[model samples]
Target: MKLETTHASADVASEVVFEAKGLKKEYDDGRVHALRGVNFRITQGEFVVILGPSGCGKTTLLQMLGALAEPSAGILHYRGKSLADLADPASYRAREIGIIFQAFHLLPTFTAVENVQMPMFETDRPAAERTERAVELLKLVALGHRLDHFPSKLSGGEKQRVAIARSLANGPTVLLADEPTGNLDSENSKKILELIIRLRREQNMTLVLVTHDLNIARMATRTIEMKDGLIVADQQVPQTAA
Candidate 1:
């Protein structure tokens, strides 16, 4: 079957980086349904927010979209291709998706640059090139000077920055962040939010963020609310001109 291609004007970004159809999840023999036929699409370079109360399946949906978890029943298309076609999803995750969690998840013993380079260590890139790329990513996150600092020496926000740099190391197409600001104070949360927005704008990355904060939801170009394992509301909000 031939796939349809709608010609988008140069001004318009790609239609969607990800598409989910009839997504459903069940655990404990139908006792718990985490997601009930959830459906959504994330456009290229768009900042999207998944907002809901606790146990609303927001994070579950995000994980499915990131390829970190599989949906019991659903169709997921990444960049218009079925995710199931990927020969090795671990490689796909490393190459296509960057994930950030509430926990910084940085290596305790490694310095910031070393943590950033960890993702690419298996690649054949020369050590010098890997170091240079790590430096560049650190600079992108405004952490070039902290290259030698371990997570123990960094504050909450700085550690998050290192995580962000590590995520960008492979230049992923989609960035999935789950409650990225949940662990930070108001000031640090704002800083992390700003950094996320900046990455979306400057890097043209597709962003899918899950959060319980309405203020954080309002910052995205699109806001989607979930409840009872289903999407309750989906809307595209106005964003500043790029």
Candidate 2:
């Protein structure tokens, strides 16, 4: 199945959310190269999937996009401003980017609603407002009835839904998901994918998802194939009826 996209072509110059030029990430005294002079631009409202085998630097690239790690060399920009020049990179990450991981990293002791409210603690929002927003997000993810349930009491799919709700707590513009469905069964994977697509459609959020599965790659508005720390292929996904 193909994903529905707003743009007729990837070349559409609406707005650039992210741009990387000669992006490189090295580790262990420059002995390990996670990204090698990678360069690409992700436009606002685009769903771009990064595909490759293990150790191909897809995750590293995602980390850079999420601002979880800094590049060793080259330039990384957000909204035409250099990431390194940001006054507070952490604030940018917390406010602008939402990240989902394969493990559904929910706190075992916290209830679903509490977990969803965790990100808001970083801001100065009132406690009551935080609770209200958390509940709204949980409802959006179809977990309103499970709001009081702990992570241990929820099913895998429910846990993932909680994670998804938590990722939106700060109202991020970009969502970065790494192997979001890798731990779920096929049916659950489909449910999560559908939820993501729906959220993107509703919010016009930019998405960068990393996965080894071709089926998941096919659901993106654009597919970017990475290999040996470099981008090998970048193409637009064909449009499909909503």
Highest lDDT model number: 2
Instruction: Residues 46-159, candidate 1: write the lDDT tens digits.
Output: 889999999999988987887777888989898788775667888777777788988999999999999999877756779999998888888888898999999999999999
Clash-forming residue pairs, model 2: none
Per-candidate TM equals 0.91, 0.93
Q: What does the lDDT read for residue 99 in candidate 1?
A: 88
RMSD of each: 5.3, 4.5
Give the range of the ten consecutive residues with the poorest summed lDDT in model 2: 1-10
Candidate 1 steric clashes: 0
What lDDT would candidate 1 get against the real structure?
Answer: 0.83
Model 1 weakest 10-residue run by lDDT? 1-10
The parts of candidate 2 lying over 4 Å away from their true place are 1-13
The backbone clash count of each candidate, in order, is 0, 0
State model 2's lDDT: 0.88
